[model samples]
Target: MTSSRSDTRSKIVDAAERLLREQGPTAVTTRAVAEGAGVQAPTIYRLFGDKDGLLDAVAEHVMATYVSAKAEIVRAASADDVDPVEDLRAGWRAQIEFGTANPTLFVLLSDPERARRSPAARTGMDVLRSRVHRVALAGRLRVGEERAVELIHAAGTGAVLTLLSTPPSDRDPGLADDLFDAVLRRILTDTAPFAEDGPLASAVALRAVTPALDMLSDAERQLLTEWLDRAISAASPVTR
Candidate 1:
């Protein structure tokens, strides 16, 4: 019985996703979804509560599908063989493609409230965070991992939205790539740890590995991170 119910829920979500993709968010009425899925309107409410709830499920379904494919690609790549910065660039390009391809779903998930509540969004972010951590571990990151993640996320999200807002014929083909390079310039070091301002470079490198220090308590790590950020900022003219 549980399996049967779960199947029914999947069908409804699948139908809603198709409708949303084909006709946009405005067309995803409960009645339309019920007809598409061959289920009663009450079943949608029973399983998903309301239209907003159903939309949330649809967003999750689509995002999970995208993330799963990307996860497979990441798993297939040998970590030691991959350049972390290139890996990050590949992921960023994938995100841009996904967002532009699914404008309706992208806009829906753009809402801060919805994004915060989305399991799929969280999963996507976790993938991004892991990639950022890899860059840090390689000593290529110029800023704190969390700050780098936020900067990348914000830039990517803005680029997609900007492109979507423009008419396709008028959109700049290189805008996304330009924005990504700008982000990289801010977050990444050109060379690893031996350039001018060696102390700042060393501090940035150490901050990246702080999470792996088993001797430090959570508070100690946090405090250490703060000190490192301050030292890094003070020593680096670019960051000051």
Candidate 2:
């Protein structure tokens, strides 16, 4: 019985998502979704409570699938030793494309309260956080990882929402790219750390890769990481 109910729930959500993607949010009425899923309207109400609840389930399902593919892409890029910046750019482009392609779902996630309640949303952030960590490991990040992730996420979300609000014909082709470049400029440096560049970037980078310093005893590695963390915190302009 539980399996049967779960299957029915999946069927309803699948139908709703298809409607959302092919048409728009307005097309996903309960009657339409019920017909699409070949289920009675009460079943949807029983399973999801209402339209808002149904939408939440759809958002979670869609984002979970997207994050799975995104994680694989990140893993493949890492295996290929792609430049960390390029990998991040690829991920950024993927996000923009996904948002624009699924405007309704993206809008659902635009709400901080809803997104915060989503495990898939948090996993998506972890992927972005890992990418930013790589940039720090490459010694090109000028800011701390948490700050950089926040900035990039905010810019990307705003860029997608702006594009979605405009008609496709009226949208600027370069807007997303320009915003990404601006975010990168704020978060990254042109080159890896050098002696003259000061200690912040180097400290950030060293802290990132500190776990791999296997020659040191665990206690020594811990001490070094603590020192690097202090140096990075002191030098990060945002921290002050």
Candidate 3:
């Protein structure tokens, strides 16, 4: 596409994302996105084909950003040698930190409707999941092929989402660390030395947020902690 066309498309996708985050997919009309983007309604159709097309573009854009970053973190965490469980903990923390830092983008990336509508978006998450599966199979973690990988992903993502949506005063910042340690301790080797370490451990502790944790606000941090509490409290079949 031409430079001006690409720029307009980017604006439209951004506007659509903003609308979806604010009002949800049903409210993100093409005309509305166009108006919000300062483009003509017909131009939206010309560029994206229709409303579904626009939504697909927007979802793909956000999902690309989220999945790519997540995959990188998982890949990086997999390289650590302290303990497989600690590496796994590092991976989980990275994932939570990412989602909590970008709550809107995380939701947009995980939207079921968007997955059904966009192959690129669906495949992006699939790639990330596949990496986690590989790690589990490699014995870096305790997840088996049956459903553990999915469960772990669900738990982690749900935890982060709940935390991001909750109020600061209602949360405890230390819960996520505690919950992560508990989960990893359950799945990782019980006899491992790194498993006993707490927040000070370099292997499991998020010393650096990869890029930076500075993007997150105080409220977002509080919400993330609340979500972690819920995730940690949830009863699982494994526990049963």
Each model's lDDT comes to 0.86, 0.90, 0.61
Model 1, 1-94: lDDT tens digits are 9999999999999999999999999899999999999999999999999999999999999999998877766665534558878889999999
In model 2, the runs with Cα more than 4 Å from the true position are: 192-198, 211-226, 237-240
Q: Is candidate 2 or 3 superior in lDDT? A: 2
Query: Which 10 consecutive residues of model 3 have the lowest summed lDDT?
Result: 199-208
The reply for model 1, stretches above 4 Å from the true place, is: 78-80, 215-223, 233-239
Highest TM-score among the candidates is held by which one?
2
Candidate 3 residue 158 Cα shift, in angstroms, is 2.0
Candidate 3: tens digits of C-alpha lDDT, residues 1-240: 599999998999999989987887777986688789999999998998988777668767866776677666656655743344445566677677777766665676567776567666566556545554544434444323323455566677678877877885786676677776665555443335554322122211221121245577877756654553333234222443
